[model samples]
Target: MTRATASGKQRRATLLGVLGVFTVHALLLVSRAAWAQEVGTVAEVEGTAEIGRGGRWSPASVGTAVQFKDALRTGHPGRVRVVFQDDTVLNIGDDSHLVLDEQVFDPAQGTYRSVIHMIKGRVRALVSEYYKQPHARYHIDTPTAVSGVRGTEFIVSYDAATEVTEVVGITGRVEVTSPLDPTHHGVFVTAQEITSVARGKFATPPTRLSDTIFRQYLKGLEFIGGGHAESLSAASPLLTGSAIPRSDRSAAFEPPAAVAGAAPGGRPNASHDASDLLHQPPGIVRALQNGNGDLGVRF
Candidate 1:
């Protein structure tokens, strides 16, 4: 071949090699995305809980796989709890609505992100152990406010009637901000503190969570600990005293005695690790008062 023809052939060969590499990389990305799409499974569902996907609604089951962009809702006496691959858990209260906006839980690539939307009602979150990773992110967006947390356990409640959004920090730390005041930055909320966001302005100052109301809410859910009990984030006494393993619990609906004395809505003390969470069966967790759900915890 002529020198000019040889040079052209070499250039074509180089271009083909580059294209082939790009094609392979693209395929790997597609496969990885499919693998990563499943962030967690529906650990528990109680009462009339339903999931909305692609505008269609279906009742959630015990082992249902919860995917990204799925909206979950519950009617009266309904609730749900979902646990991710990394052990991070989410609890949805009765008459509440939440959407899983994003989930990227590939720890190998150091990509850990969780963004959920609280359209209405209540949601409790237990940030994963991987949450402390620099690139990890976890947030719950409400109609009026957005709460960002790090390795924390917190509650977010929204009342559509008054348009009030409440954020209660139980462990770790949380930063709350409202879109109304983008320039206002964020309001840092520590454990045992609570914050609120009304219809218009930015977030309110952090305050101590109300013990009475908090326990009342817990009692109502009656989250059982075993035999279809909800995940750890639902409060089977995530108290300061001991470590409750999920695998050790019996199938009965009763929780350990330590659970009732867990000091409702208290400040975050020393033991904020994942070991503090009580272990329970994965289904229909009702809050156990006095170690049993027969009667609500009245103190």
Candidate 2:
């Protein structure tokens, strides 16, 4: 073989080796980032927190990347709040064991499926408004019941010994159903409402949660970082506190009675003048319905 030709072949082989290494490294980086993207951040932590992944337990602190299949546990004096990709926050109270069973968020397509397994203890969540942008949904699997919602805030606490799951609604509504009673459709607990699910049975119908009890549950569970007041910004423009007024918790869920010529939905007539939209609108008929419009004052 010609010496020059052999040398050219050798150089080509060397070039191919360099390109192969570059491609492999590039792929490795992509995979690593993808793995990290499937995780959430520990926004705030108090006392002691630990995470179990791959059957190994490790101490956890703020900013821990809590990934799917990782179980987070907090001691008696511990609490942790995890912020998901779309800024949804789950505040876990002490003596709690939570497993991130599934989490997928795709903003461009507006699709999300968040599922968590609560082995025991309590968790308060502010579901992102983007949750229902397309096919978004969230679920919490407790020992006694499974709770689901689209975008709202609620709390779930389970007692392993009693096999009971207590669910309370702070802002949005929650529906709880026992796995054992698959056919039973559960009740929807609205703001300031509370309910319980017993072992092998569906949830009890929701009842009003007294203001005193509701305030007690909120003791340490609040958004700590990222502008605490904007906790529900991702859900809607209204402040989280105003979702249900103290005087009218049930009014938030019940549809307004229809005035004579009103459209199917209770919204002010589309043709109405903007000035009168809040109270009276053209073609809304004689009876003025939906008291105040204060319930939904926009941001």
Candidate 3:
């Protein structure tokens, strides 16, 4: 071939090689994205859970965490609610650390599995129909215990101070055990039962919180909404040490003015939401009253 023709042929070959490389790179990116979407997704955030930096969740702040067949990344000192593709709901409380252990969905084999490792703090989970599958397994692990869950609503709290693990079942059932003890394992706990496990021994019949206390907890849900720091601060003095009379509890439902911005009627903003002030749980609330402000110790 002539020299000019040879040069043109080399250029065409070089262009084809570049195009091939680009095609491969694009495919790799798409594969990664698809895998991530299959992992799990973040459904919502009630109050403040830091996302990137300086992002806080308030009454006005609602965010979603979405993970597809991959791990959902997070930072410290935040609360998040995640819904896996398998229709499982996982609520992560503040100061807690977790990672998606495994995610597999296969209809042919009738296998659907979800696993998470709780590195620290508290987590509440609600499992759905996926648990009915004989082959399905859902688990959450802490330093002291492993919770085997099958279609249930439950709360797990890890208190590093006492080195104690507490599990409360709202619905369905759960089996709690120490990985070290295989033979000495205990019985399954049903709804409305709170199980405490420590030193490889399970407590006999979990302590039951009174209906009044439990009702207060349900009312505390309103505190999850942001915008009430100042009002809560002002009322903190009078409400201190005094049992929040059941009658006044309904009035406490009002969101703090600083956090809520304005009242529904012509009333002025009076208080702040509990979320904005205290990031810890009920256990830590008492500690805070005792003049302790360390979250690490409380968690």
Q: CA lDDT, every prediction?
A: 0.63, 0.63, 0.51
Model 1 Cα RMSD, 1 decimal: 11.6
CA shift of 287, model 2, Å: 38
What's the lDDT for candidate 2? 0.63
lDDT (C-alpha) at residue 295 in model 1: 22
lDDT of 1 by residue, 42-101 (tens): 655678888776577878755455555668899898887766655676778889988888
Clashes of 3: 22
Poorly placed runs, candidate 2 (over 4 Å) = 1-37, 223-299
Candidate topping TM-score: 1
Q: How many residue pairs clash (N, CA or C atoms closer than 3 angstroms) in each of the candidate models, in the order given?
A: 11, 2, 22
Error of 1 at 231 (Å): 8.0
Candidate 3 lDDT (Cα, 0 to 1): 0.51
- The 10 consecutive residues of candidate 3 with the worst lDDT sum are 52-61
Candidate 3, residue 4: the lDDT equals: 100
TM-score of 2: 0.63
